[model samples]
Target: MNEDSLQHPKLERQPMEPRALKSIILSTITIVCAVTACIPLFSVLIMLLYRGGKRLTFQLFYTLPPGAFDAPGVGGFGHAILGTAFMVGIAGLISVPFGILAAIYLAELGPHHKVSEIARFCAKTMTGLPSIIAGVFAYAMVVLLMGHYSAWAGGIALSLLMIPTVMLTAEEAIKMVPNPMREAAYGMGCTPTQSLIKIILPVAMPSIITGVVLAVARAAGETAPLLFTALFSESWLAPNNPTASLAVLIYNWSSSPYQNLIELAWAASLILVVLVFFLNIISRAVGGKTKL
Candidate 1:
């Protein structure tokens, strides 16, 4: 043995533990399964891009759908885009205030009350409610009452779906505010209302906005509800008439015998996917900004 060997002796390598080997095997399987799951998603995205990218044009964003006798690729779904935005805006108006109020009640004012418990349970149950049921409900309540399909009916339909998501998320976000912050506010002579308005709301706003955006995204992509409520329009969006939406347009066009309509459907699908993806990115950005 040399001087170097005296300073640092070589140690014998031990065999891998059975538990360690099992963990490695399981982890590898998990990774493989995750990759396999992503394959279909990536494949669909690729197909959308390849089939839809070529059809995108400036005119497509502003022009109306082609007439029955018109040539292929002569029109667009601008009305549908506007109609989707209009209905979603209406939904936000109807849902946001109600949801926030309910959240405040559940998370702060009457958190331990029986009513709050029941309200919370109902919200959770609505989360899993079928979208088509909401449509039917809206049709019965709004469309039938008004005696026609209109954007208002569509908005009401979307609002039903949006409310539960917003209420649940806002409640969770409000609950996540630190107890220390609440205590500090109370100690500093702040009333419960003042503290909630000035401190709690501002702190939880990002997360609440995240939920709102997600709800809007879901509403924008819904077709069944719109079909039962708004129906479909080929002309410009009118408040008193049936309105178009990208979701309904995709459904109507995708099955058409005309090649152009099918292509436009693909394009509409791509646009809808991109819009949802963008909303998700915004939600992540806003949610990540606040630690609470």
Candidate 2:
């Protein structure tokens, strides 16, 4: 063929066909949908910063909630802050080990076995359940038994919410390890157990840590579960006592008629959002350092 004919092949300057045009349209739609989905998140962050940023003060960090409506005082949510930490700590204690072990079993031992399949199915199913259902489960199992709401009940409810998240994330992390890495360890006479403990787990640690942190973040902001399990306490109390939380405090104060309480709720919401943001940052940092 002549150079001109070769340069002007049948497809050279042809427009995209109907099928390709439709695909391009669909892809644009997908992008638009994804961007649209983020609008609410952006709106919330903006609203929280605007409403809450102005209300923050040193006293907001150290003081307790206001006293009775008749003799209201300038105070903050120190009790709720401490209560949130206490319950989340308890949740971490319960969920972290159990989740890691379950992930190990699923990824390192019998990923395709019947029992593993059953476990994975359950985890997936549990992940779909509402936070309120977890609260109800904890209420029936712990509150009914104890005859009252307590931080323990709240912790358990949060743990239930954390487990499936950690499990699925950790399992996928472990599975991401190369098959050749295990083979190399085996060639060096490492037992499966040793290889798993020394190689696989270390390799997977960053992702596992990230997963656990994310789960903890999710647990930290849960309100419905704490409402059913902790029932809210404004007074300073032990972990065994009914506890207040940032989420529940926000929920309560947001609905209150008092302007000050509403302001406090806004502040608490900002703090919670900041805390979750930091946790994510820490996770990314940890994950990055491990890979490096």
Candidate 3:
């Protein structure tokens, strides 16, 4: 062949492919969108820190809210902080086991079955369900049974909101484990249950933790559900008692006629935002450690 014909035609066309150009364009758009999304989030964080940082104090974590109309430095958010921790902890306890187990059933034990499909649909649906609806459900189910609002009831409401996210995340994580690993476990005389308990769960643990952290972050920032079920208290949160939460306190105090309480509210808002931010960071770290 002549020199001109001998050089591959594909080499000449490599730089001008329409498909490659399209992919570059699409990737650039995705990056721009992601950066754009982060702007509003960083703006919120800065705003909260500026508005609330002045009111944050050591006492904020150790003492109760002070007398009405007290100065900004006089009172703290101890009750709200404690209550938030307790209520969210209870919610975590209630949701994590059920969500993980259900995810295991769907992803590892019964993939492609009709019942699993139905359950997965229900979980995905719940993931989008309004937080207030979960609150209402908890109110009707738990509060009506007990005749009053309590921290446990608030937890039940939050668990409902948390469960769907956890289930979806865990299911996705479990699925990320390769089919070969499962087959190997089966090859080694492991029962399906034993394989799930040992091989699948251990492999998926990091991602599952990431999911739980994200779910808790979402639950922590919620207020509408707590409004209906938590029934905020200004005082200490007992286990079976209606209790204050940081979000609830922020909502109520932000509109106060007194500037000090308003400042306290701002501070609580900052704390809540920080906590959620921390959880997100942990989730990201754990997710990065996963091989996938």
Candidate 4:
């Protein structure tokens, strides 16, 4: 070979300008699409606040609707608010323990066993199941057992919706716990259960709380399940005795012919959004504190 050919090698090269331009264009397009999709939700929120904020008084929180269009506001939503809280609370109570335990059992005790596989499959299946189906299942199971729509029935439906999410999230959180910490605990004479409780759990608490907050937010907004299982109330004040939730009330009011009812529905939607937002903020704060 000639000296030039022996000393020099062909250098494969790429044009930096085209690649950079293509990446910039793709990023811009992606952002634009995301912003466009978010617009409808933002618009609805703005419209709600503008048109319904004036109607959202302290009285609206406390009173229920009157029988007549012109009748004085005869009732408050204290009952509905309480009902929503109770139903969601009961659902969380049912879901969190089962989910977290199942996740622990799967991760620590039986990673590849038949039972764990079945549990995983069931959780995945449940995650995609519709809220209405959960309601129907609750109605068929618990409501039939009780012979009526009750808050417990509603709770069962919400639990069905929540458990899958909790299980998946718990598993992921536990998995994220550093193996070194677990080994250290084990080296220090900690049992598997003790290590899980004291080390893994504390370290993974932020993720667990995030999962719980998301579950609560989802359960709060669910109307179809409550509609079929809990039913609705016009004047009922107790959740345990079958009462309406804010979601059900919003559904009823938004569909009513009266403009005032529609306005109330918008106001209720705004309140629900605000409550969910605050819950998310609190969840973040808790997560941050746990990290420290």
Every candidate's CA RMSD:
2.7, 3.4, 4.0, 5.6
Rank candidates by lDDT, best first. Answer: 1, 2, 3, 4
User: Which of the two, 1 or 3, has more TM-score?
Assistant: 1
**TM-score of every candidate relative to the true structure:** 0.95, 0.87, 0.88, 0.88
- Per-residue C-alpha lDDT of model 2 across residues 62-138, encoded as one tens digit per residue: 77788647343378998899899999999999999999999999998898899999999999999888999999999
Best by TM-score: 1
- lDDT tens digits by residue: candidate 3, 59-88: 889888878756658988898889889889
Candidate 1 segments whose C-alpha is farther than 4 A from its true place: 1-16
CA shift of 285, model 3, Å = 1.1
lDDT of 4 by residue, 22-50 (tens): 98889999999999999998998889899
Candidate 4 TM-score, true structure as reference: 0.88
Task: Give the TM-score (vs. native) of candidate 3.
Answer: 0.88
Report lDDT (Cα) of residue 269, candidate 2. Answer: 96
Q: Candidate 4, after superposition: displacement of residue 106 in Å?
A: 1.2
- Regions more than 4 Å wrong, model 3: 1-39
Candidate 4 ranges beyond 4 A from true positions:
1-16, 71-75, 288-292
Best by lDDT: 1
Residue 24 lDDT, candidate 4, scale 0-100: 81
